[model samples]
Target: MSRFELLVRGGTLVVPYVGTIRADLAVAGGRVAAIGLDIPVSDAATVLDATGKLVFPGAVDAHFHLGIYRPLSVDAAEETRSSLVGGATTVLSYFRTGQHYLNKTGPYETIFPEVLSSVAGHAWTDYGFHLAPMDTAQVREVPSLVEQSGVSSFKYYMFYKGFNLSADSRDAKAFTMSDEYDLGHLYQLMEAVAEAGRSADRRVSLSLHCEQAELMRLFIDRVRADGDPQTLKAYSDARPPLTERVAIGEATTLARATGCAVNLLHLSSGEALAAAREARAAMPGVDMRFEVTLHHLCLSYDELDGLGAKVNPPIRSHADTEALWDGILDGTIGWVASDHACCLEAEKGDELWPALPGFGGTALLYPILLSEGMHKRGLSPTRVAELVSANPARAYGLDGRKGNLLVGYDADLTIVDPDLEQEVTTDLLLSGQDHCPFEGRKVRGWPVATVLRGRIAYQNGQVVGSPTGQFVAR
Candidate 1:
C-alpha cells in the first residue's frame, strides 16, 4: 500500500518537457509521489476525479503589483482572493519604498518586516516579493534582504527617476508620476545590485522598467502642446515604436555594462521584441528576458477609443498587434502577465488624453489569453503552459517548485474546461477594482478549479483555503 495524502485521477497531467499524458497522480508530504494507472488509492486521504478535464501547472504571475501604493492589509488580502479566482497559485510582486509604498525611506530590515507582517495570514496563494532599491542604503542591503527574508529579486524603474506613479494626492485617486535618472544615483544603484547578485548563494536577480524617462517626458509634453483628440495620435506618435526600440537598445547596453542578468518588464510592441532578440543575438553571453501582456496581444488602438483603452506604451495599431502575436508564436516572447494594476472608472478622466492609464484584468487573465491566443490563434496548449507557467517560473527561479506538475514539485495546479465558453463581464470580477477593459469579450477556456499545494484553494468562483498562502523567499 502506498502512503499517499491525496490522489488525483482520470486527468491528463501535463508536464513541461514531456508533453501531456493521462496518468493518476498520487501526492504525499505535499509532493507528487507516483504517477501511473490504478495505483491503489484506498490509503489516500482524499481523491479528486478529473474526468474530461485538462490538468496543467498553475500560473506563476511574475509581474504583479499588489499593495504597491495602497495599504498592505487591504491590498494583500483582496489581491490574493483575486489571484485565486484567476487560477494563479504563485505571485511574484515588486514592493517600492521611496514614496509609493509605506511612505518611508529605509533599509530592507525596516521595510521587509512591516511587509511580512501585513501579508501574514491574509493570502490564499503563495507569495514572493521583489524589492525595488529606492535609495543607496536599500541597494547595499540587497544581499542581506536575500539572507534575512529570502527575497532574491530586485527591481529598478529606469523611467521613474525620482517620483513614482501613485494614486491621487488630494483626491487620493489618480496619481501618475515618472521615474527620473540622476546619473550618480542610478549608476551606483545598478553597481550595488550587480555585486550583491554575484555574492548571494540563492542567486539574486535584477529587473528593469526600460522606457527612457526623458523621452517619455518630451512625448507627453508634446501631446499636451498639440491638444485635443488629435493629441491622442501625438501621444502614440511621440512615444512611437521607435521610443521602445531606442530604450530597449539602451537597456541591453546597460545590462551588458553592469554584467547583470536583466528581465525587461512589459514589452508591448514588436520593435521592442526585435530589439531584445537583436541584443541577445549580438551578445550571446548576455542574459536577458522579455514579456508582454494579454491586452497587448488582443486589443488595438481602435478598440481603445475611450479612456479605458489608455495605458502606458499605448495600445498600438492593428499591425503591431499582429506583430506581437508573431513574437508569441515564434517563442521570442517569454512569459505573459496580467500587469493587473487596476483603477476605478471614476478615477479615469472623461477625455482620452488625461485619463488614468490602467484598468483591471486580474479576473479576465486566463479567459482573454484563451480566447485570443489559444482558441482563435490556434496556439498549442503546450505553448500556453510555457508562456503562462514554465518560462515565468524559470525566469524568477521558481521553476523547480512552482511551474511544473512533475514529482517533487508543488501540487499547485489549474483544472480548465476548455470547451466551457462564456462572455466576460465586469459583474463577475472579484478584484478590489471594479472595471475591466476586456468587458463583454467572450472566451472559450474557463478555470473549473484551482489547487494550491494539494488543497483546493478556489472552486466554482469562491476561495476555500485558510488564507495560508506562504511568502516565498527568492
Candidate 2:
C-alpha cells in the first residue's frame, strides 16, 4: 500500500499571508498530510505532474445564490459543478424566505431543513447557508441557528427597506414577505447576532447589501420623469453611490449602537468606499469588514452596455472600478468574492428595469483575479490567494479546514498554468446560465486541474466523477 493517497509534484504553492513557495504536496484520506520536496513518486497511489503550474487553495466563494432563480436541486448540481471549474471547493450561499427563493415566509427550522434536503445529494461542492432572519420570528431563531445548526452568518438587504423594484408589485413587502423590514428589524437582528456571537465559539455577523432604498425611490422617480434612457448608465443613475453612502451610515450607526459585527457587501462605488472608511473612523467600537465583488472591480457601466450587467448597487464608472482596485491593494477591502448568481439570459432580457441583476461568474473567480489582479495589476500570487481563498474562509467560519494549503487542511486545490490564455465565453464557464457579460474578455492563468478532497473532480474542462460533496457544518 502507498504511504500517500495522492501526490502533486513540483508546483508553486500560493500560501495566504505567506509568500509563494515551491513544493510538493501529499494527501492521504482527503487531508493534506505533508508538504516538502522530492517525495518518491512510487510512494503515492496516484501522482499528478504539476511541474510548471501554480497550486492555489480552493476558493471559498463566500457570497453565492444557489436556487435563487432555478430549482434548488438543479442549481446544486450544475452551479457547484461550475464552481469546480474556478477552483472553488466550498460555497456559503445565502437563503431567505423571500419572493425568488422558495417564494414563502416561514420558520428557518422547517425551511432550512428543506433547503438542505434539496441540496444534499445534488451538490458538487461542500456547501453551507447564511440564512437571513427576515422577520422578528426568525430573529429569535438566530441563537439556535448559530449554536445547533452551525449557521453563524446572516444577511440584510438594505435596498429592500421601502423601495419596490417590480413593475407589477406595489410594495417592498411583496418582495421580502416579512413584517417591517426596516431599521427596526435590522436593529433587533443586530442585537440578536451580537448576543449570539458572545455565547458561541464561532463568529456571528450580519452582511448588509448597502444601498439606501428611500433614496433609490427618489432617484428612480427623477430618472423616470426625465428622458430615462434605457442603458446601463441610466440604471447606474437610478441607483447612485449616494444611496450606498447613506445606507452605510445607517447600517454602521446601528451596528455601533448594537455592538454588532458587520460586513459591508459589494461596495460598488468610490463614494461608497469613502463612506465605509468614514464609518470605520466614526464607529471605532463596531467591528466592520468590507467585501468587493469581481464585477465591481472589473466591470463598469461606462464600458459594459449590456443590460445583463445590471446589478444591485449597479456597476459604477470605470473610475469607480479603479477606485475599488485601489481599495483592494491598499488593504481597505477584507476579501473579494464572486457574489455568483446564475441568472439566465431570458431572465435578464432587453429591458433594463425588469431585468434580473446577477449573472454567473464563479467559473471566473480565480481566473479573473489571476489575470486582471496578478498579471495585469501586479498583485502577488500570495495576495491573490488571500483575497479569493484564506480571508473569506476566516471571515465566513470555514477557516482551518478549507482556506490554505496548510497541513491538516482539506486537500482542495487547483493546478493552474500561469500563462494559459482564453477568451471568456458562457460555454467555457459550464454554468446553467445561457449568457455571460464578460463573454469576450481575454484572460490569462487558468486551472488545468481542480482537486477536491484528494480527488481530481475537474480536469481538462470536464467534471471527473460523481457528486461527493458533503455539507459543511459551519
Candidate 3:
C-alpha cells in the first residue's frame, strides 16, 4: 500500500510567522502528513517536482462578490476559475438580500439557502459566505442563520441607511426593504451578533462597509454641480476620506457598546487608518480587525484606467497608497483581500459617475502581492503568506483547516516561480468580465501551480480538473 497519496518534492516552503525551509511535503487523505528534507516518494500515488519554486499556503481571499453583477451560477463557475488561476484555494464571498445580488428581500431562511444552492456545484475552490442583515425582519434571523447555516460572520453596510443611492436616484427602497438602516438598527444588530458569538464554538464577527451615506449624498451633488463627476479624481473627492473616518469612529463606538467583534472592511485613506487607530485606542476591549484591498494598495487615482477603476470608497491618492503599505508592514493592517466583483464592460460605462462600482482582481491576488510586497517593498515571503492566507483564514473562522502548512491542515498551496514575469492583459485573465483595470501593468513572481486538498487544480496557466470544491462551513 502507498504510504502517502501525494508527494510534492524539492521546494522552498514558506510558513507564515515562520522562516522558509527546503523540504518535501507529503499528503495523505487530503491533509498534510509530513515535511522534511526528503520524504520517500516511491509508494506515492502522485508526485509533483517543485524544484526552485517558492511554495506557500494557498491564499484565502476573504472578500469577494461572485454574483453581484452576474447570475450566481454563472459567476461562481467563471470567477472561481479565475481565483484558482491566482492560487486561491478558499474564498469567502459577501452576499446579502439586496438589489444587486438576488434583487429580492426576504428572511435569510429562504434567501441564504438559495444563495448556497446557486453555487453548490459550480465553484472551482472551497467557498463560504459573509451575510448582511438588511432589514428588521432579517435581523431577527441572525442567531439561527449563524447556528444552522454555519455562517459565523455578518455584515452591515453603514452607508445604506435611508439614503442608499445618489441624491437624484430614487431607487433606495429597491436596494433595501427597510426604512431604517440607521444606528439604532446597527446597535441592535451588533447586540445580536455579540450574543451569538458568546455561545458559538467559533469566533463570530461583524464586518462593516464604513462610509456615511448622508455625506456621500451631499458630496455627490456638489461634485456633479461644481466638479467633474466623470473622472476618478472626482469620485474620490465626492466620497472623501473624512466620511470613512467618521463612520469608522461611529461603528467602533457602537461595537464597543454592544461587545461585538468588528472587522472593518477596505480602509482607503490615511484619515481612515488614523481613525481606526483612535478607535482601538479609545476602546481597548473591542476586538477590531482592519482590511485593505489590492486596488487600494497597488492602484491610485493617478494610475486609473478610467471608469473601470471606480469602486466603493473609491481608490485614493498615491500618498494614501503609501500609507496603506506602511500599515501593512507595521502590523496595523490585519489582512489583504480582493474585493473581486465582476462588473462587465457593458455595465462600466465610459462616464465614471454612471459606471458600476467594482471590477475583478481575484486573478491577480498572489502575483500582485509578490510583485509589490516582496520585490518592491522588501516584505518577506512569510509576511506575504500571513497577509494573504493565515490572517484571513483566522479572521473568517477557517483557521484550523485552511491557513497554514501544518501536520493536520488541508494540502492547499501555491507554487511560484520568482523569475517569471507577466503583464496584466484582459486576454491573460480568466474572469468572464471583458475588461481589466490593471491592463498593461507588468508584474513578476507569478503562481505557476495551485494545489487544493492534495490535487493539482491549476498548473502552467491552466485549470486541471473539473469543479471539486465544497462548501466550507464555519
Q: What is the C-alpha lDDT of each candidate?
A: 0.73, 0.89, 0.88
Q: Per-residue lDDT for 130-247 in model 1, tens only?
A: 8887666667787677677787778876655433445322112223333334445556666666677787654556777666656766766666566534433454765677778777
TM-score of candidate 3 on Cα atoms, chains taken together: 0.97
Per-residue lDDT for 52 in model 3? 97
The list of candidate 1 runs beyond 4 A from truth reads: 162-180, 201-203, 230-235, 351-354
Query: Candidate 3: deviation at residue 192, Å?
Result: 0.7
Residue 147 displacement in candidate 1 (angstroms): 2.5
> What range of 10 consecutive residues in model 2 has the weakest lDDT sum?
168-177
Off by over 4 Å in 2: 164-174
Tens digit of per-residue lDDT, candidate 3, span 193-307: 9999999888899999998877877887788788565788888888899899989989999999999999999999988999998898889999999999999998898877588
Candidate 1 TM-score, C-alpha based = 0.91
Error of 3 at 82 (Å): 0.6
TM-score of every candidate relative to the true structure = 0.91, 0.97, 0.97
Clashing pairs in 2: none
